[model samples]
Target: MSHTPTRLRVVRAAAALTAGAALFVGGPAGVALAAPPAVVAAATDHSLHLEGAPNARDVGGYETVDGKTVRTNTVFRTDALDKLTPADLAKLEGWNVKVVDDLRTVYERALQPDKLPAGATSNWYDVLGQAPITTALDLQSAYVAFIDAPGASEAFASVLRDIRETDGTVLYHCSAGKDRTGWTTAVLLTILGVDRATVNADYMLTNEYVDDSGSSISGSLMGGGVKQEWLDTSFATAEAKYGSFDNYVHQGLGLTDNDIAALKAKLLV
Candidate 1:
């Protein structure tokens, strides 16, 4: 059926966004965060779901502390869209996403080039999954690494920067949109001071996006993978390296104070 408010509420009640971040490798020293309530709600509210793209969703209608809302049909995160059904293709076309930013590395892109929606401006940006942020780097290790990296935040900020400078619906995603997509959206919302638990909750929604085998799809885009440890590790790394989600978005993304103010003006009401 549809994603529930209870699934989203778990994030705000018990998930301590910062406490479990210390345990990036998955131990008792850190907190266990969940997906943000707003992100999950957005996926539900907009009815942006696709029959083929499991995680494809728009980041719209989220409330700001100032009582503003994030614009709808602006941002979406999902997997490679090289295999969309005609009906699903029509749905994305209806959304009119103009800029499709492919976050996959060159190698991944070559493996499965996106079948971008007609008329969408396709761009590329590498999320650097292979390049470890630290010497003891391990791919698919735990949520800790995923939570603690600056690179993902930086990449995510670039997308935000482009949104203001240009106009169009921008859709972005990596191989699965789990590690990179999760981190990027988490940082963006956190910059708006949404909440820590909510951020984690948003990150965890990958489970819902995927299937029993982990890797799943919505429309043409896919999410999750068999035994993918990087999802958690990537997040943990961001937390350990950057201090907090907001810090990662501001400092790691290199978003200047003016840039942030502009983002606030553009996003918040």
Candidate 2:
């Protein structure tokens, strides 16, 4: 299934800033109000079943290098919540999801506004705000642009900051759950000390879960499969700019070492 939207890139570019209100926590001022730490429990269902959302899954249980494992049910990645069924809502409610980080642009959100679990606050984090915001079209160029964009770091940092401060599950997603969402997952796993092999493996699972049936693959490099190069490019891009992924998180994303520690404290066992 091709993820690219064959539209004029320039048109989307002009519409990016006007799409939604930015939701990143303002630095320093946000620190004083950060929520108290909350312990996470095991997920009732690690993988979700939803008519509207096909790619939702818990990003927990992977072991860190120090033998600790990521806390289950605390973090989730999904495609979109606009099509969620009642059963899906009930399931999410059972998990007590608190934060729904929608990574889509304003136009995308307007087209399919999320049907979040009752009381789960939604935050708009435009993953492509610093790039030439196209849906699925021109993914390679788009991915490179995302890596180069200064706002990518801030966007990533805000999600991490939110994860550290939220008392419940933080479900983040883009349109297909494989690009913007995928990169976010990769960064989090890296911060937790998950090996590159495991990180790449987890990323490839999107292909297994997201049903791309009937989607066209024209102009797509991997025929809509989460290409290995896409993952490679993300890491390589980080390496080129920040010397390493860890540095990228700390320096490029403007996250302090203490911030990373707080995230691990909240999300890892």
Candidate 3:
């Protein structure tokens, strides 16, 4: 004979099941289930996070129209490396950064000399070589000077030549890496067939990567932070004077087709 289930036993089983469900629905696990997900910052492939150098980033990883990508570890733009620690020096050496192209003026360089890696070579190519800006009331004035200066073409040409001919990584920088340095990279990217939008975006990234609380361009002429209008002005000016960036490279900066071809060959690959 088999024993039958008691009504009391069935009722107790149902109550237990209900209590267990309630625990799972309103307990610690339940709280975790209802909580919001943690937030994570997005990573940038272009940025280099050095202790001493902010606004230091690889100009590579950008795609061109011909399906070729700018090679990483080839060209880098940064703020001053004046405060680089020994570890920072080692970091650059590990990256095989062989040449440092300083775009700062003589006075600026003297104020804060770059601390280069042991074997790395430094080239002082001031944007305004010999001729100083008379009154840098704004970034526009500075750009105007750069565009019209007698030695501007030679100076900028040297930067491109360095990038093309340097055996290893070529790192370029100014004091804050916003005005002069920004223009240099802009012209370089434009030469590599990058669109105007991408070029402008790269120039705008200085605000995100560097601190500008005390940073100023020629004593408050252009300060606070990198402005989009300033970059816009540069593009407009290039258009007005030279018709296009390609023409600007040849006529304004005096870079030849051979020079640009060499740059693409070395940096694009």
Kindly list the per-residue Cα lDDT of model 3 for residues 1-269, writing each as its tens digit.
11111211101100000112222100011111111121111122566667888777777767666666666666788877888888878878877788999876665676668999878899988666444434233455566656666676677778888887777778998777777778889888888777776777787776666554554432222233467677777777777888986688888877766777777766664
Candidates' C-alpha lDDT: 0.54, 0.67, 0.65
- Output the lDDT of residue 59, model 1: 58
lDDT ranking of the models: 2, 3, 1
Q: lDDT tens string, model 1, 21-88?
A: 23121001222222122333332443256776666765555665555566555567775676667877
At residue 25, give the lDDT of candidate 3: 6
The clash count of every prediction, one per candidate, is: 48, 5, 0
Model 2 C-alpha lDDT per residue in residues 81-163, reported as the tens digit of each score? 87799988877887778999987666667766889897899888786765643423466655565567647667777788888
> Of models 1 and 2, which has the larger lDDT?
2
Candidate 3 colliding pairs:
none
Q: Candidate 1: misplaced stretches above 4 Å?
A: 1-43, 129-154, 214-247
Q: Model 3: what TM-score?
A: 0.78
Which of candidates 2 and 3 is the stronger one according to TM-score?
A: 2
Candidate topping lDDT: 2
Question: After superposing candidate 3, which stretches have Cα over 4 Å from the reference?
Answer: 1-44, 129-132, 215-224
By summed lDDT, the worst window of 10 consecutive residues in model 3 runs over 9-18
Q: How close is candidate 2 to the true structure, as a TM-score?
A: 0.79
